[model samples]
Target: MPNPLDPSLATLIERHTGPVKQLRPTEHGRGSDLTALAETEAGAVFVKAMRDRGRAGGRRDSLLREIAVAPHLGGLAPALLWGEADSGWVVGGWEAAEGRPVDLRPGSTDLPAVVDVVRRVGELPLPEVAEDWPEQRWDRFVAPGEEDLFAGRALLYTDWHPHNFLLGPAGCWLVDWSWPTRGAAFISPALLVVELVAAGHQPAAAQGLLADCPAWSGAPAAAVDAFAAAHALMCRSAADRRPQQPWLAAVADAAECWAAHRAEG
Candidate 1:
């Protein structure tokens, strides 16, 4: 029942989430701490072990951020049960999403559902971002004017891949809120498009999904191209940082393809 990775956390959860049933390793995003799937008396929750180094002053209360934003986007994501900023173990109820990692592959029915979720996410109101939170840059490889399209005080999950979105009982529920960022406008959707392309979705399909986005109607194509380029650079940087990360490399390749396609038009 207790996770060998963090025995102390198992003990803590017994007190917080009731009896523990099982613990298993789960998918995790880079630039964060170790994570796992944990089941307890309360329900299933994601466990993220925080690292001491890196930015945000050691995790910077991610669970707190999720707690703040979850209520607002409750239907869009799972419910947060409890967490500790110092320990970096945030727990939330798990929902069964219809899609899986490979579901992002071509011809996967999950594509339409993913597109729908991305559209819905675009419509969700931005959560209030703390002024002290680290600011996300928009002008990375993209032009400067493209930056303001997504800037706001809203809380954003930043990571918007089909992997992060689970097709649960209610609908698609987003997971891994560890990298909460301010401003929910262009960043998440931009990430989603890049992810869709990376997951083997056709270029036209991915673009159509983005084009259909109501918020992006008046958005500059150059901005999406810039974001796509920037996302590629970021992925490559991440791959470089984690040389063994195959997923990052695949995503980088996809980003390149999307960038080239955008260049043609």
Candidate 2:
């Protein structure tokens, strides 16, 4: 049977002018439903058509929300060219974000750069998101539910995986914005640290950089924990939803560690 949840590509083209050429399938953890290419003469665009879980009401709303906020977050990440709410399509002409995907494997070259980027990202002004995931409520979603923990808020891109970014000509650019939320106390950096540790490096190695992070430098440890949990949850959820994804196993494992570590502390 045809998948009832599959996105309708025709619906996207119908909204735009000129013929749309469907480009190569972009690789992502949740199966390749994202379409890329410019219109006959309308500049390059990346269309994130809602499919499967993304079609669920909340996910659809988040995609639309990202479209609205992209213009403000553009310089900090990838620039968004055009987008439509109902169609789940956002066009972005690609830009460069330094370094390759974060490889936790021992002696990986990208680790240092990843650490730097993490700190920088924290410092950037929270993007122009129409809705901000509340600071208090954000903990429930990103935190591990521990007591005596408090977290400050920052705009966070849930998926900061290396592959989601590129080190192209205009400097580093983070492409996907399907998942973003207001800062949870510690969930954002905490989760990233867990990913680094799970990848085989000592969390202490990056601790200095993380501690000195200008973006969230003064954020409480609990906040870090919350961000970590949220990030891990995202990876784990993606793995559960898209088993065939090559990165799921490792990413999920890393995310799980983030969750586990916070649970312990």
Candidate 3:
């Protein structure tokens, strides 16, 4: 399909990269979001435009978070070139990253690279504005107490599905920073463990991926267990409320396994 950019947005890009030659829509994100690759004199520039600012499970200010965090991600994420608001939408252009989606199977080589990315992202400078601590966000889902486990100084990318990653040449380049959470440095890795179960990994095997990360090793066991339980409750609640979709049901099952594994551990 042609680039979905309206004349105003198209004019804006054309002015930057000369008359656009090829515009291709990307299928990696939600339907309401427009991600496209535009061929220009410099090469391919990735563009993301949302009808409004929000991600799958974020506050209404999600668009603001993405815009604020994009500039500081350095090599771990695509660099933002420019951004603007156009006709009820927020749009930005980024240095395009090329790679295949990560395969999160039990013994995939990509695991190590993903771990490296997690550590690097953990090291990135915190955005000026921090979102609420992860514990606060997941608090309602947990049984009653156990909120301290989610508090930390690190910037976290809360969404961890395979589609959000691209195992590129330099390393595993993470594409979406839409739902950054302010929390423990190890939280991202912990979230990855749950996703691994959804992707067919046993809990122990998936948790093993975090062994080398200092943050994950430093986290208290009880706190980690609390996070797993909270995530499980959140996933189950989501599945229950929505139309019966296989992926949601499957994720809920994965969350259950991780939470159960944590409980048993």
lDDT of each: 0.62, 0.55, 0.77
Q: What order do candidates take by TM-score, descending?
A: 3, 1, 2
Q: Each candidate: how many clashes? A: 4, 29, 0
Q: Please provide, for model 1 over 1-265, each residue's C-alpha lDDT reduced to its tens digit, 9 standing for 90 to 100.
A: 6556566556555665577687767654544445556676656665545543336534545645654565666477665555554453543333323444426677777667776766676677655454445445554655666656455654555776656767754656666665566663556666676777877776767767767766555456666666767767777778888878788888888777877787778
Quantify how close model 2 is to the true structure by its C-alpha RMSD in Å: 5.7
The list of candidate 3 runs beyond 4 A from truth reads: 1-4, 52-60, 131-135, 143-145
Candidate 1's displacement at residue 4, Å, is: 4.3
Better of 1 and 3 by TM-score: 3
Give the candidates in order of lDDT, highest first.
3, 1, 2
What's the TM for model 2? 0.67
Q: Could you list the CA RMSD of all candidates, in the order they appear?
A: 3.8, 5.7, 2.9
TM-scores vs. true structure, each candidate: 0.76, 0.67, 0.89
List the lowest-lDDT window of 10 residues for candidate 2.
Answer: 90-99
Worst 10 residues of 1 by lDDT: 90-99
Per-residue lDDT tens digits of candidate 3, residues 1-265? 1455567667766655676778988887663366788888679998776664334444325655677778778677878888776555677788888888888888788888877877777677666666553436787866665676677788888788787888777667888777787887778888888888998999998888778877788889988888888888888888888856778888989999999988987
lDDT of 1: 0.62
Between 1 and 2, whose TM-score is larger?
1
